[model samples]
Target: MENVVPFKIQIISILATLGFMYFIVRQIIRGKLREEYSIVWFACTIVLLIFSFWRKGLEQISLALGVFYPPSLLFLLAIGAIVTFLVHLSIVNSKLQSQIKDLAHEVAFLKEKQLNESTIK
Candidate 1:
């Protein structure tokens, strides 16, 4: 990207990003993607939206927050995004664990039934 991006290009980027975000939301709503997986992308897009519109605002916010530099905000956001993704994965993992437990129980029950039938024979 140019140091000073043209307004038209910025507008186009913003529109393209918005379109992508809309597509993501549609996919999530349609069950093609889960809420957990969608959050990181949402945060990423929101960051991009902010950057696309008001990158200078980041310096102001950083100054207000007593940060050394503005670009550090990107790193902060990256960490936040990672944490959000990890939380989502944890939730999904818990759901998977429960399902696995249920399946194991079902398998055990079937095996026991089979064993009893074999003993009867």
Candidate 2:
């Protein structure tokens, strides 16, 4: 019965991974998700699929990481992925903010120049 349970879990995991990959690909194809974002998701799903198919490898990694429970490793990986993604978003946001400020300054300068010319005329 215990062996059967693990096998069932493995099958379910594989199906779920496939479903996730399909969803990401569909979103990318429809242009709902950008390629850069989709790349991260695709990489995540592929890693999940690899661990799903290779239960032994997952177990070894968990043991190596000193995680007594293998499932906990999945949670750890997920949290790490979220943190990494948030950092990427922050970097992009910072760049956009800088560009917006520069553009605003340029517009203000141009408007001021135009006003000065009109007054002189």
Candidate 3:
């Protein structure tokens, strides 16, 4: 927002960002989140930290990028990041589905072969 954020708000934002980074790191350590997947989250948090500390940062970036409105640029970047993350997740899901299907077929073939051998004996 072009409107001024109170000093309290800025401090709160910084604290919240640090908290988020801590949570992400914990998740990675616990194996709940993968490093590659956390990269986007970390990048976003870093950008937020920068903007929180440097209030004029967004305006400068918007001007440099030729965006008339700074908030819109932030929204655009957020949406792009979310879309990229979703696409990556979708690709991973597709691969897992294929692998699962192949495993099912292999298991079925082994059971059939085992049954045939038992019957022959």
RMSD after CA superposition, every candidate: 3.9, 3.0, 2.2
Kindly give the stretch of ten consecutive residues in candidate 1 with the minimal lDDT sum.
1-10
- The Cα error of candidate 3 at residue 117, in Å, is 2.4
Candidate 2 local Cα displacement, residue 73, angstroms = 2.0
What lDDT tens digits, residue by residue, belong to model 2 across residues 1-121?
Answer: 1231288889998999999899988988899999987888889998988888877886777779898887788888899999999999999999999999999999999999999999999
Rank by lDDT (best first) = 3, 2, 1
Question: How far in Å is the alpha carbon of 120 misplaced in model 2?
Answer: 9.4
In angstroms, the error of model 3 at 69 is: 2.7
On the 0 to 100 scale, the lDDT of residue 91 in model 3 is 100
Error of 1 at 21 (Å): 0.9
lDDT of 1 by residue, 1-121 (tens): 2233457877987998899899999999899997877877897898788777974666667778998666677688788878977897899899999999999999999999999999999
TM-score of 2: 0.74
lDDT of 3 by residue, 1-121 (tens): 5643567888999999999999999999999998998998999899889989998777888889999888898899889988998999999999999999999999999999999999999
Each candidate structure's TM-score, on Cα atoms with residue i matched to residue i, is: 0.65, 0.74, 0.85
Best by TM-score: 3
lDDT of 2 at 43: 90
**Candidate 3 residue runs with Cα over 4 Å from true position:** 1-4
